[model samples]
Target: MGRSPCCEKAHTNKGAWTKEEDQRLVAYINAHGEGCWRSLPKAAGLLRCGKSCRLRWINYLRPDLKRGNFTEEEDALIIHLHALLGNKWSLIAGRLPGRTDNEIKNHWNTHIKRKLLSKGVDPITHRPIDATDCERSEEKKAPRCPDLNLELCMDLPIEMQQEPECSVVPSSTTFLLLDYCRTSLQMN
Candidate 1:
C-alpha cells in the first residue's frame, strides 16, 4: 500500500511564510472563501502546499482568533470541561468562544498537566490516576467494596458518575444524589 506522504515538504524557502504570501492567501480566501484545501496552493499561487496554507490561516491568520494568555475563567472552563469530556479538544474549543483547538490542546499539555501533577493527580486519568493516588484510592476503596466488580461500574451511567459538566447542576436538586455517591462510593 502506498503510504501517505509526510506533509508537503518543508524548508524550501516555504516554511517561513512571508507577509506577501500571507497577504496573497488572505486575499484569495476573502475573494473566494476556503474550499478544497488540496487545490488551494495551485489557486493561491503560494510556494507552500494546501495543508501549510490551511494551518497558517486557521492557527495564526484568522481574524477571529483570540490571542494571548487564557484567563482564570477560561482555565476553570478547561478543567471543568476536561473532567467532563476527557481530551476532546475540539469539543472543549466549541464551548469556549474564540478559542482554537490547537490553543486549547497546548494549554492543556503545558499548563494543565503541570498543575494536575502538582496537585498529586494524573493528567491522563484526571481522577488521581498517578501511581500514589492510584494506590491510595484503590486501597481506600478495597476495604469498602471488597466484592465490587466491573459489572457494577458498567451499570452506572457515565453522566451520573464522571461527566464534570454535570457539576453545574444546583445542589438543591439531584446533586445530593451525586454527593451521596461520592461519600458512599469514594469516587472523588
Candidate 2:
C-alpha cells in the first residue's frame, strides 16, 4: 500500500506565515525544544504542516543563523568549496558554519554563478570560459600511456664483480619482468 500523507491538506493553512504564526511556532519550540517534526504542528497548535514548520524554523527563525549579506571571505570559501565538492550543497554548508544548504544553493544560483561568469569562469565545470575547442576535446579524450623510465644501477659484491654499472631497460622489458615473476610464483 502507498504511504499516508504528512498532514490533512484540506485543514492545513498554506501561503505566507504571519508574524503571529511565527511567534507561536517559536514559542512552542522554545518551550518544548524541537521534537518530532511530524507531531510539532499539532503540539504547537499550528494550522501548518510539519514540513512547513521545520523549514520555517531552519531557514528563517533559527537563532544561530548568520543573517545579512555573505562576506567576501564567505564568497571565496563557497566558490572554492563548490569547485572541490560540485553541487553537494549540504557538504559545502558543513564547511561554512551558520549557513544552511538551502541558503547556499540559492546564493549559488542567484549570485555566485553571475560572479563566476563575470570573472570568465565556467560555473559548472570551474574551467576557464574562453578555453579553446582543442582543450575542451582533450578533456573528453581517453588518457594516453604514461612515459616509462626503467633505468637500473647496481653494485656487485667484492668477490663477484668489478665496478658498479648502470643500464637502461626498454619499456617492453617490463613485460618480461612480469612474466618472470609469474613463472617464479608458479614454480614456488
Candidate 3:
C-alpha cells in the first residue's frame, strides 16, 4: 500500500490560504518563534497541516523575502549554478539569498530552460543540441566540445600556481570552470 498521509487530510484546510490564516500564522511564529512542524499547527491553533503552514510561511509570507523580478545577475547565476549542480534547487537557492528553491525551479522550467533551448542548447546538459535530435547525416559526426586534458599552464610563476595558505578554497573559479566546459559542448 502507498504511504499514509502526513496528516488528517479531511480535517485541515487546503488550497489557497486566507488573509486571516496568514496573519494568524505570522503572529504565532512571531510570538513563539519557529517550532517543530508536526506540532506547529496544533500549537498555533491552525486548521492546516504543518507542511502547508511551513510552505506558506517560507515561500510566501516570510518578511525577509525580496519579492519581485529576478535580476539579470540572478538569472545568470541560476543558469551557471544549474550547469554545475543540475536540478539541486535547494543548493542553488542557498547561494541566492531571498530566492526559494521552488521559485527558481519554476522560473527555470518556464523561462531559462526554454531560453537555452531557443539558443540551440540542451538545457539539462547545458550543451548544444545533439546532432541526433536533428535530421543530420550520421557520417558527419557532431562537433566535439573543448577537451581539458591538457594541464592549465598559467604564465604565472610556480609560486602563483601553488595553492594559497588560506583555509577557504575559492569555489567560484571552480564553478565557472565547470560552466565553461559544459557550455562548450556542441549541440549539433
Candidate 4:
C-alpha cells in the first residue's frame, strides 16, 4: 500500500514559503533541534506540511548552506561522484556538505551532462564515446530482447587456425567476419 499522508493537505500551505514563514521555521529549529520532520510544521506554527518545512530548512535555511555557482573543484567532485553513484543523488549529496540531492540532480541535468557530451564522454558510462557512433545520445538504440544473454567465442578449424602461408585469409575466417558485419549492420 501507498504511504499514509504526511498531513491534512487541505490545511497546509503550498508553493514558495514567505520570509516570515522562513524565519519562523529557522527560529523553531534553533530553539529545538532537527529530526521529527513529520511534526515540525505544527510545532513551528507554519501553515506548511512537514516535508515542505523539512525541505525548506535543508535546502535554504540551513546555516551552513552553500550558495552561488559551484567552484571548479566542486564541479569535478560532482562529476566523479555521479560517475560512481549513477542517479543516487542523495548518496552523492551526502559526500558534499550543505548541498542537497535536488540541487546536485538539477546541476547534473542542466550543466554536467552537457559538458561530458561535449568532451566526447558518455555520461552514463563515464567513458570515451565509441567511434562507431553507437553510444551517442542522439542515436536511436538498437532493439534488444529482454532475455538475451550473448557470448561470442572464436574457435577455428585446425586448417584455418594455422597462420596462412600467403597473405590471403581463409574462407572460414572471411565467412565469420562477413556474418559479424551483417549482424552489426542489421542492428543499426
- How much does candidate 4 score in TM-score? 0.68
Candidate 4 on 1-188: residue-level lDDT in tens?
99989999899888878999999999999999897989888988988889888888888999998998888888899999887878999999999897889999999999999999999988887877767545432232332322331222244552344431223345776666667666876787
Tens-digit per-residue lDDT, 1-188, candidate 2: 99778899999999999999999999999999998888999998999999999999999998989998999999999999998888999999999989999999999999999999999988977777766745644543422222223334344552343433444455677677656666766776
**In model 1, where is the ten-residue run with the lowest total lDDT?**
146-155
TM-score list, all predictions: 0.62, 0.69, 0.66, 0.68
Ranking by lDDT: 2, 3, 4, 1
For model 1, how does the per-residue alpha-carbon lDDT over 45-163 read when each residue is reduced to its tens digit?
Answer: 87777788889999888888898999989998999899889889999999998899999999999998899889877676666644764565465445333333221122236335443
lDDT of 4: 0.79
Ranking by TM-score: 2, 4, 3, 1
Model 3 misplaced regions, further than 4 Å: 1-6, 130-137, 140-188
What lDDT would candidate 3 get against the real structure? 0.79
Which regions of candidate 1 fall more than 4 Å away from where they truly are?
A: 1-13, 128-188
Give the number of the best model, judged by TM-score: 2
* Model 2 worst lDDT run, 10 consecutive residues: 142-151
- Please tell me which model should have the higher TM-score, number 1 or number 2: 2
| Sequence-dependent TM-score of model 1 | 0.62
**Local distance difference test scores for all models:** 0.74, 0.82, 0.79, 0.79
Error of 4 at 107 (Å): 0.5
